[model samples]
Target: MSLREVIAQMRQTMASLGGEAAVLLQRLAARAIRGELRRLAGAGSRVWTPAAARAVVDRLRRMLVRLVAQLGAALGKALTSAAATSLADAALFFETGDRALLGHVLPLRPVAPTPAQIALAREGVFKASLGRFGALLVHAVEGAAVATVLLGKPHRAGVDHVALALRRTAAAHAWELQRIAETEASAAYNAAQLEVLLAQDVPGDRMMKRLVATFDSRTGRDSVLLHGQVRPVREPFFDSHRGHFYMAPPNRPNDRELMVGHRPAWGEVVVDRWPVAEDRRAAPAPAATRRVPGQAIRSAKNLRAGDVLAAPGRPRIASVAERGGRIEVRTEQGLLLYFAAGAAIGVLAAS
Candidate 1:
């Protein structure tokens, strides 16, 4: 076949492919959005009533709008690159009259971003993060209000105080809160997908679940645990200031399960259980007492079998039984404590 004829044939093929690509992209976008909405509905139903579910969807849609707006430039550049490649191929067919010449013009690759370009991209992501944080703050406030109405029957005053404190604390650490949002945004950018930003399984989602569970517990409402949902109570929950709170089983005095709070800065989740004298007596000594020269356990990964570790606000010491990505600590009462990877653990005695 003549080179001119081959070039003409290739141009026709490219034109057909381009049309198909556009249709595919549009379909993919539609499916992605619908799938996202369904996922949000499922997650929202776990913690919210039907009316509240609509609010969750609304908040998520706003966040998605903000993300799309901030990412406009990036998306535009991608589209431009695609269009340029197509134009280059068409131009090559006219000039060279050879199919092989298409590679010279098209290069088969997009131009890489320079350092300045990367900086600009990061700045856009940061702005998106700020928007996300705003949405999260608003959601938190709304959730608190809903919780107060649902759980504040007997202890209305206490619920009101908690709601106020949550809002105030979020406001107080506005900078830190934005930082968290930026981190999440950056991660989503690196993944090159808006789905990460819109996903219902993010940390903020988990925090909302925790808020719902905490409210239910406080209000004496029975909560149905979702399958495979690891309760946050297993790990030491920290506030913005890093003050740790641990969950405790019902004790003799109160006979009510407690989410014990410590350190006044974060405000306290007032529970019926008070610190009993026996609790202090039962607690293992601080890690500093067991530190041997140059053998101090610094990270959760360093834990080994036979090491006694102190859990925050828990009286009984747990002995480290296994160590790997996750560390397992078992108390004398056969209670198994599972620490996720990178979870901070206080070493009471290094063995």
Candidate 2:
């Protein structure tokens, strides 16, 4: 084939590989996430348990390992005419921990082609499918690269006819193969990261409460999960901790995750059906049931510095507050709250 046509064919090969590899990597990550979620749901816990939480992180690490091998194999096939590339042997690993997510892709010194890549060189150069006659130029100039480094000899005695006018097509092809491999792996890794972000903001405040409960209070994981959810959320959200985007019960601005399965209308006119607490469901759980017997909570004005305080809906946590001038809430984290005076803050127990 004419050199122009051969170069055009190689370019076509690269463009095709980019599209196929991008789709493949994206699909692999999404499928793996779905599989993990389905498996978690099947495990039969109404809640996302501690084991499931750890598994979520662990699964990401495992996914990376599989991604590397699959990407390697895919690149191998694409770069090949009749022989495979050693892209799969690129060797990638992950070092993930509680607060650490690290991945390693071994350095590629492709100047010295591996056994498989050498075969690839032979196929591309001698076979004339991709490298064509032009590729003979570089190998001859660069100390006979294709023969010595790739073929393990000075030159192919009779087969390699070194034409001075030829270009360095084989070396360029090998470099392109390495670049494609790197790009594909990166796309897959980015997809997995998105999955983790979605997991952190996993759509239910109740579920998230249970998830954070699994860790000790000292760990402060509730905030961590909340912070990680920022990237995935499109519409206005209540809080990262709750992960509910549609409508927050308390004074929360809302949209997004709450309306799951609906096309994301980033700034849609999603005003709530009723005024904030006008909906019975939005109202706080009854104080009678939440309160301990004989411990009626007084107005914020009458409460003292050491008084126990609780919000209307949440009864599990009791905060020892400085004073409830406006608002004071003891959530999963027992931090002292300071609210504006006359803000209709907390319900305090009579001393």
- Give all candidates' CA lDDT scores: 0.35, 0.30
Off by over 4 Å in 2: 46-52, 81-115, 118-351
The TM-score of predicted model 1 comes to 0.22
Please tell me which predicted candidate would have the highest lDDT against the true structure.
Answer: 1
Prediction 1 global C-alpha lDDT:
0.35
| Runs in model 1 lying further than 4 Å from the true structure | 1-7, 10-17, 27-31, 43-54, 63-78, 97-351
Taking all chains together, each candidate's TM-score versus the true structure is 0.22, 0.24
- Model 2, span 146-215: residue lDDT tens: 2223332222221122212112333334344333433332222222222222333434411111000111
Q: How far out, in Å, is residue 343 in model 1?
A: 78
Ten residues in sequence with the least summed lDDT for candidate 2: 205-214
